[model samples]
Target: MKLLAGLTILMIVFVVFGIHTQQQILGLASDMQEMVPNISREINNENWDAARNDTARLLEQWNEIQDRWDLFIVHSEIEQVELYIARILSYLSSEDKAAALAELAALNTQLSHIYRKEMFNVQNIF
Candidate 1:
């Protein structure tokens, strides 16, 4: 009876922790997603300076959450985001609007994929 009670309590804790992890992942991903569009718009308007600054800010935010993100997400996903940011920065420096926008789109897709993959749904459970 004591062992059963302990196992039940452990299971409850695990479930709660899983939910908390999901929330953190969703929040961090959403924060990054919100910034992507602004950068894209800046690029579209040919505002190189603004786009550069925003991209820098996005990189800063990513760095800040990176360790925390690693705790809940795959390292490859994090690496992909970092790669996209680097490419975007390079494209921005060269004022290559097309390349920068394409990178931003890829970054957005990667972020979306990260959050969706982490979501606690039936698809993930199987």
Candidate 2:
């Protein structure tokens, strides 16, 4: 009983220390899942190599996450994130990438503003 208690304590400690790291891993996995449809679009457009590369990157992170949680993530929001990544990665040149990234940053800023606004409204009600 004492040994079991000690193991449980250690497990809890490890989990507490690693939750953020695990979440980052999950975030990456979510990005990969989101990118799949964008990748399919690229494939349909006859960009096989680019599509395959994008798919591989996503699959690598996704498979790693699968090793952690059997279910992976069942959220539709993950698909949106992946699509965002794919849209940004579509740029072929470095300059294009920078422009794409800038646009993404702006989009994210807008999303955060909307989210915060909603959150504040919710909080004000209580």
TM-score of 2: 0.35
Superposed model 1: Cα runs more than 4 Å off? none
Residue-wise C-alpha lDDT for candidate 1, range 50-105, written one tens digit per residue: 99999999999999989888876779989999999999999999999999999999
Which ranges of candidate 2 are over 4 A from the true structure?
Answer: 1-11, 59-126
lDDT of each: 0.94, 0.52
Total clashes for model 1: 0
Give the lDDT of residue 124 in candidate 1.
87
RMSD to true structure for each model, in Å: 1.3, 10.0
**Roughly what TM-score does model 1 have, to 2 decimal places?**
0.93
Please tell me which predicted candidate would have the highest TM-score against the true structure: 1
Tens digit of per-residue lDDT, candidate 2, span 1-126: 999999999999877756654555545434544565565566456575675576457646644654444333334434444455456555433325454545445435433433333332457457
Error of 1 at 25 (Å): 0.8
Clashes of each: 0, 3
